[model samples]
Target: MAVNLPLPIPENLTAVAGIELGHAEAGIRKADRKDLLVMKLAPTATVAGVFTKNRFCAAPVQLCKEHLAGLRPGAPIRALVVNTGNANAGTGESGLAKAKETCAALADLLGCAPTQILPFSTGVILEPLPVDRLVAGLPKAISNLKTDNWHNAALSIMTTDTQPKAASSKVTINGQTITLTGISKGAGMIKPNMATMLGFLATDAKVAQPVLDRLVKDVADRSFNCITIDGDTSTNDSFIVIATGTAAVEVNAIDTPEYKALFAAVQALAQALAQMIVRDGEGATKFITVTVEEGRNVEECRKIAYSIAHSPLVKTAFFASDPNLGRILAAIGYAGVDDLDVTQLNLYLDDVWVAKNGGRNPDYQEADGQRVMKQSEITIRVRLGRGDAVSTIWTCDLSHEYVTINADYRS
Candidate 1:
């Protein structure tokens, strides 16, 4: 087991006083372990969410996609239900019914329509959920809800994750402080289609739903959707933003520089949380950054970057502290992009120029690459010698434990 490292929660998150957190140990996967989460948003709040693009997505994702439309400019979501240890995917019609039932139950508690509640699930796939356990745990969980239990809420929704990932940020909007708190869970099977993982971000800002939706989608495209781990998108991916309108800032629209500042803050929060997922990746000790620049187009740049990031050989090499540059070169060559010209390629390992003009630099040394790879984090720069388009992708090393864990995931 990896040693427990201190996960410092981000700064400036105490401003959102209206939001509440609730979780219960449903015994769905293991006895005496929490596995259910409910987040309460204030009425009159605004909400926006993005879901997975997979055709076989979970029932909750589909439900959320439809319900988020209801949380318009003045409307808001009442509750969010997240369950771990059972994805509730591939269950066909029954799963859809259960998702609706959970939403309806929460709506009843909150005295709102069923369409106002959103449900999300993660964990094992294809198994019918033990709805009894969830129901039995609901009342107790609701009673246990607290305002500042951010850490516990992050922990309760984890599956195969060594540590809980949570991030917070405080931004000043019209001189009023707004707090953003988010949590995510993905140790394996992560390749964000929307969230490409399970993440929820809540804030006390008063942004309109349309603005929030557009900003959330743009941020997700550059952050969560850009990263890869195993390149297998899950059936239960979700990312949501809830604005409680309690910040007391009457921010009008997204056209001004202040709006740009708030948007930047939200994007930063999403990127921070997304990086946490990779840092605590299943069996990962090193975080790798892959940058592909000078591509003919944005798509080609990302294609090459993801190909290198998702390459098992590249990941294992990173794990072993071996800077196998040849594997990276080969990955880019076969990224399904055209224009093969290694002579124009430039490479760097952790910012140290290593490859130049399709050949190893004279100053490159095995010790240099090994030293760079030994750091907890690394960056690999690949200049494709095409246009100026560039993209950065984040991932983690692949270790034997990764194989061991997935090999016996169901056993």
Candidate 2:
């Protein structure tokens, strides 16, 4: 079961002005299920994305990079198509050709060049994509496109997610209102090397391509990149940010106050969406926040935070509501901080001071630890006492159901 996660209210999911979304039941992997999504963009929109760093990336991921990299100032991305149930990864040349063919098919429907469309896929890897079914679903998806389909778009791209993840917020800058709405999906095979899931955020603000590109990477690093579930990155991890240029708030450079405001608003929404993915992680019962503070740099802080988050022993202990916190210390020790001084370290489980200065806090009790561990939401705070740097990562406890889910995933 998901931990403290709720379905997003459809009425609250405001739509961006320049993007229209539609979904279709393609039955790519299962019968009568929403498995395809098309997002048609206004001509004025500019798109930017960051994809998985896995060497064996999916064909669609490669195509997206090529399409975005090949963008001319006048010819921005026109549309995005996402299909669930089959990740076209590790299929070599033929898969690449099929992905290209899919793009061509969509471009023909939209009366645009094949390169103007960015393609995305997520699901079981190493299997040939059923391109004919996905292609056949395109017209139906495009036919139902609407500006207010963010909620259904969220559901259409889901693979292992227990529920759709979507969020919306509005931020005003210079008298112009910017609305940001986004959706993300992933339940397992997560640990974003670049990002182990799919995230699409669209805003009606006007932004230069260069600025949007920078924002996407920065937003992703602080959001999707700071999460882990099972520590396994996918071949099709992607996070895309779209700027429709419909609103009067124009940001052309990264140095402006407008850009700062936009980044904050987008970051907050992205964080919310990314956290939802962890909260709904496969069989997750607890949403865990691993925070490492007072580090020499952000890198070291993140390394230690990820170490704690990815520790199976610690995760299982969290699942069992067991305060076997020694596993946490062990994880921190092996986190590659060679010059770390354990004597100065302090650890807290929520409000309970479990460890003080590298030793068990005298006032700490087993009951106190268990109290926090048993909660659906828990925070693991580690004060490194090294410097001013801090980093936090969201994760979920490893449960037996997670194992069962994966063991029979393709069956």
Q: Considering every candidate listed, which one attains the maximal lDDT?
A: 2
Evaluate residue 337 in candidate 2 and report its C-alpha lDDT on the 0 to 100 scale. Answer: 93
Compared to the true structure, candidate 1 yields what TM-score? 0.95
- Every model's Cα RMSD, please? 2.1, 0.8
Q: CA shift at 41, candidate 1, in angstroms? A: 1.2
Compute each candidate's TM-score over C-alphas. Answer: 0.95, 0.99
Query: Alpha-carbon error at 42 in model 2, in Å?
Result: 0.6
Which one is best on TM-score? 2
**True-vs-predicted CA distance for residue 323, candidate 2, Å:** 0.7
